[model samples]
Target: MKFPIAALLLCLAVSGASAEATYGAPPSGLADHLARLKRAYPDVILDYDKTKLTLKSGATIPISDGRRDKSFDELLDEPDIDDMFAFPYPAHAKPAAPAFNADPGRVRVESLFREIYGDCRQGAAALKMRRVPWFGGSVLITTRQGVDKALEAVSRDLEKLPKAMQKYLAPSAGTFNCRAIAGTTRLSTHAYGASIDLNTDFANYWRWSKAGKDRKVTWTNRIPAEIVDVFERHGFIWGGRWYHFDTMHFEYRPELLAR
Candidate 1:
């Protein structure tokens, strides 16, 4: 069967770009994907400059030029349309990581998320919350922007797995919290209630790895593909995919998954 024109273009784009990070390269089928999105939500596309993603409904999302280190807040809040691919999500599973730093969905500018998901510290914002039974037990999470629905989809799907596979999920480490990332004032995805962490025991974080002579941290992950696949299908990105890996974390961000 023939793939969509966009999918073909995307494959070409990915092939042309270095394979280190999934989102590091420009989206090959971006034009096609955008066309599809326009068809699905005509109201969202208004007009466009060469690099701007304009919505007819009055929102303009910019595309990054793939040049510099945008701050976490900048990437999350004012990211260029291109920045959406900062981390590469697995288009199809292969045995290895995409390539060095091929993290297409990793970028997030704080203000952007705060605009859509709301701040968790403000009790009123995260109030529109609900619970999903995680591995047969309940856990509270934000319902903003259909996040609750997405996570529920994840839960329902995970429930079908064999009982042994299910054991790693239960006793979930956590779901919604107002906290800064370790050692950084920058707010975490958790602060938006869009993230979740699984059992700590089976997880591996880059920080836990030994530092080099230069003191830079090395990346590593132990989370199984079986688990990552389940989360990705439901709009969650795996922390295990990061160069600075945090194997236990997952968060909802479909814009990153548009590829």
Candidate 2:
């Protein structure tokens, strides 16, 4: 006996649909995830216009349609709402490996930051900078865009941590340098004073991982979750979460945590 042609087609269709549902779509709770982030860090999200995210400080960033990297100038000029979530957060209750193309906080357009924070290299603007005491000593950082207040908040919370944890933060790594990324002309978060790296000994850098060409990076983390939770609660995201991990660093990109 032979099966009917239509029945076979229907079976194939169902199988294809199941496969798509299993692997093609992202997790369904993006809205809920954003809500959790909002609850954790209130007032961080200024505006959520369709594809544009305007921060409370009146800086607007354009979210891309998930295609390409926006230039520093382009990112600064007009960032969309989607751009805010370019960096990914933990999607499950337990820490699972990140999905392919799971880089959530990776999307940044440099100009958007340079506009609000001022170009640090110019020297004309960065002169208005101030210092925040990270552990015991202080580190000079930019004051533009309420960043000083945010870092102060971060410091206050970090100070409450146990002494062992605090040691990883001091003898600071420096901040507010007007320099491009290590290898590229693109500006780094360090250039804006929006980023900080903890003690070098306690951190991890992707370049340090040497596998063969096209070698898979092994994700290793020693920084306590307690430290990361504190930073995220204050609207900072950990570099440890990135595929290209920088375990001892955190940056102030509240828009990414904004709902």
Q: Residue 109 lDDT in model 1? A: 54
| Model 1 residue 95 lDDT score | 25
Q: How does each model score on lDDT?
A: 0.66, 0.62
lDDT computed for candidate 1: 0.66
- Model 2 lDDT on a 0 to 1 scale: 0.62
How high is each candidate's TM-score?
A: 0.72, 0.68
In model 2, which regions exceed 4 Å deviation?
Answer: 1-84, 91-97, 124-127
| Residues 45-80, model 1: lDDT tens digits | 555555766654466666555755444444544455
Write down the RMSD of all candidates, one decimal each: 11.8, 9.6
Q: Residue-wise lDDT of candidate 2 within 70-133, one digit each (tens)?
A: 5433433344434445445752123334553344565555655566567767774653678777
Find the 10 residues in a row with the least total lDDT in model 2: 19-28
